[model samples]
Target: MMKTLICNMTTYMPKGYSTTPVLFYLIISSRHLEDIPLQAKKCRNSKVELVIVSNPEFIQELLPSAQRTALLYHLSYLCLAKFPKLERILRERATETQLLFGSSEALLLKCAATSQNLVSTLLPSLKAAVEKNKSVLAIKSLEKARVWINEIVDKVEQMVKRYDKHNHSVASCTSDVLNEKAETEKQIEQASKEVDALEKAVIGLNQELWNNNQEIGRIEATIARKNNELQNHIRESSNKNNGLSFMVCLIPFVGPLIKSIHQAQANQALAVKTQAISNELSQLSNEKSNLKNKEWNIHVRLTDMQLKLATMKLEKGSIPDPVHLNDVQTCLTRIQQILIQIKKFWEAVSIMLEALKDETFADEHFIDDCEMKETFLKTITTAQKHWRSFGEYCLSARGIFSLQTKDAYNFLETSPSSLSKEEWKRQYDAVIVKLNKICPEVCTPKETAAIA
Candidate 1:
């Protein structure tokens, strides 16, 4: 029946739960009251909850005197899970039977079991039980020690196998970690060298960029200077062309005026020559009048001499002398020839004066009015001033003047007659060309009119 009960309790026990409390309960109910006191002693030392013991008298009857004392002593030390009514009954029974009444075993068990350290409870109980029944307690102790020794041996074997497996895995993991660390160090070294090379290349490129910028600046300045020179050349060429154009337009109008001036000069020269001839003729007339007066005085003297000789002859009653009469005749013939030469010279002088007066009047009538003359002179003066100024400017700017221009200016300063008509015209054209080369504005019609 006890075997069947143990089997049924083990079968019905919950999985994964502790078997110590169940085994303790089964021991209290079994016919083995010898170990009941030891089991109760163990349960009092550790955390084990026990059911209330039934059939206390039956358990008491089964135990010998020494075990009975030990069981009552252990029961007195129960705490944590208590059955008050059952505990009271067990105490009363123990007192009446004198099993633990006033004994040191009962007193020492109570003191030890109630201590904070439970190991203090074990020695006292074992000593008391051994004193009471040495052979029985010794046999039971040896059996319990053998069973605990077998359990410890099995657990140690299992721990050794688990430790070996864990050590093997840790060694393989450590080797893999070391290999990975070596590869990472090699890659880091290569990356640092590449970074250094790139830095040097960047520095070289920056210096090249700076040099290129300086060269570009110099090129820009040179281009600007060349552009200024080109602009000046173009402006000078344009001015020269304009001046030539103006001179071409003016040549026709100036030609007739110049011809008139030359003709007027020629007429003035003729008038001067005519006045000289008239003065010479007046001197000749004065000389002829004086000679006539001398001839008349001679005629009067001859008449008076004839009258005197006739008077003397009448008084003397003789004819006049023949030598006196011959002298008088010679004087008369010389007077007549001198008078005819004077008359012929006066007639020639009158005809020459009349012809000169006609030619002078015609020349004066053909000349322009005073205002026109003034305007023409002013135009020439202003053109001369402008031409002179331009010539000076060209000399200052270019360091020299054209030979044609210098020669033209020198010719203009001299007498117009020094050059022939065609030669004068050529010099005038040369001056115009020079003026065009220097400044075109002075040759414009508006400027010419303003000067006039």
Candidate 2:
């Protein structure tokens, strides 16, 4: 039977045997065979079965190239019943052959149910490849996330730096504004105090001016009384002369009596002339005292006005109130000009007084009637000229002061910028020039230095 099976396998097992046909051939061949040694089973079984086991080298050598994998698959099935000793070796060699030369899908599909050992050995390597792919994908995703996070961190840091710089600049600007506001407030307070002080000073000056006006009125009244007394003395002396002339003409025969009466009249007239000179000297002394008082009051007013002007100037530096400052300057300048005129008037009066003191009035009671009349006329003309000059000086001073005060008021009412610095300086210099003209001997070194 082994001989017959070996001959049939050799004849029918072609290079292209289907897996089902090859497996059916191995099962039928195994069912007919017995389990015995090849040499002992030669006479008991068929020659076909005996020949298949006895000559394994011949079956191996007869297998076609196309049928080797199918033959191995079929041989593994037969080894389960007829060839048990070759089962492990057949499966190992078939698996190695399929792995090296066959497609993986075809090999796994063909051997899946019958090849448990092959599936078990490959399970670990398949799982490792899948785990390795998952690790690579996770690494790529982490790298992308890290790049985006780094970008966000850099952007946030830049924004923080910009905010810090902006905050610092705002803080600095706020501090500067506060400081400027404080300085402005301080300047306003200082200006207000200065203005108040200036107002008080102006009120005081007005009171002083009123007192000076009252003093001038009293002086004028006293001068009028003295002039009336002088006129009465002149009238009485004229009547006595007319009576003497009538006696001298009517009683020429009684010459000694007329001469005695004439001598007594001459003595009485000399005594009356001495008394009149003494009274004139006393009146002149009182006038001098009044003039001195007026001068002192004017000087004090000028000094106070100048001090107030200085204070106003200081306030103007901060407040810039041009109109008020200009008014103060104008009033101060006019007062200075008036003071200079008064000084000039005083100097002229002194010269006139010195000339009067140097003059020698003749005692003309023993002289001819014409000579006596000539002396009296000359004395009256000199006194009238001096009195007229004093009245003219007072009138001129008053007129000039009134005009200057009106001009100062006008200037104050006008717009401040209308008077340019150069124009104002020119006007001030003109006043100084007029003062110099009035009193050439007056020293003005301090005023010159201040202008400079």
Candidate 3:
């Protein structure tokens, strides 16, 4: 609902009328200003000035008379103004003809009008004024509507700006993610190239390893044959010494003339054979020592390579890849097992050498004199210790080989042609050296003593 106060300027006094009469105004109510129609009959006799007072508070000011007079129409209020002040003024002017004339006028008007008769006098002028006010209100409503439309436009613009901001943020995030993905792909490609190069190197190494293994096998065979020969020579030399000792003792008891002739011939043959066996034993021993040194050097090299390979693997990453994790674990397990076996074998070698020391003392001739027995026992003990040490070295070599094998297997499974042949050969030689050192007696001959 809207409210406004309107003034009517058309109502006025006539030129001959000698009355200080203010125009009478009526408060009109309607649903809207435009809905109220002009009424010429309602205005003519009533001398009413119609002013639209939409503000309910101002309507009371227009009707200040003490008596409340009401005339009703369908959903409308028509008011006629009356007051005691105006009545007393009219009564004191006691002009009988004028009073009779006013009375006659009132009666004639009452007789002439029907109960529904409306004075149409106020319609033409009042309608025009109301129409003007309606136009003003219409223009005001249009202005407000324009302001509302502008506010909606502003809200829509803000919404568009916010959408653009969010879209930009999303685009930036996508670009960053794409860049990161590209970088990761580049890293993976680089890693793959390195792996390819490493594979080629490993392949060459493996071929070399095969050649070295063959060489080591041949060497082992040679050593075994040489050892067998040395063993046979040692046994023969020992028997010859015993025979000569027997000869010397027998000759001392026999007649000197006959004994000298027989003894000289027998001793000459025994000495020559003993000297040959002695030289062979010395040669074998020297070769054994040389081989042991070589083997030790190879072991050192192999260990260094293993350490390097392990470092490379560690450098790769902490999180085990799904592809390699299982292989790595299996290799580690085998390495552990090989180490355990090596340790057990080393202990067994120690125990066997200790038992062999006892066996060497079973010779009654060597253990006859207390000083000689002590000396012999010391020699045998030393020899056994050396042998045990050599066996231990072989065990160490075997353990290293197992670990290297694991590494090789890992490489081969992933890429067959990795290490160079020369590299593999070097590793293989190293393994052989360690093996030879671990069991020096197995690779060399025990020396034979020559009897004079």
Identify the candidate with maximal TM-score.
Answer: 2
Steric clash pairs (candidate 1)? none
Q: Which stretches of candidate 1 lie over 4 Å from their true place?
A: 1-125, 190-452
When superposed on Cα atoms, how far off is each prediction in RMSD?
88.1, 76.9, 66.3
State each candidate's clash count: 0, 14, 37
Candidate 2: C-alpha RMSD after superposition: 76.9
Error of 1 at 101 (Å): 50
Looking at candidate 1, the ten consecutive residues that score lowest on lDDT are 1-10
Candidate 1 lDDT over 236-308, as tens digits, reads 3223332211221111122222223323443455434433433332343333334333433443333334334
How many residue pairs of model 3 clash at the backbone? 37
Model 3 residue 139 distance off true place after TM-score fit, in angstroms: 99
lDDT of each: 0.28, 0.31, 0.29
Candidate 1 Cα deviation (angstroms), residue 391: 99
Displacement of residue 414 (Cα, Å) in model 1 is 99
State candidate 2's TM-score: 0.26
What's the distance in Å from true for residue 48, model 1?
Answer: 39
lDDT of 3: 0.29
Predictions ranked by lDDT, top down? 2, 3, 1
Candidate 1 TM-score, C-alpha based: 0.16
lDDT, candidate 1, equals 0.28
lDDT, candidate 2, residue 223? 38
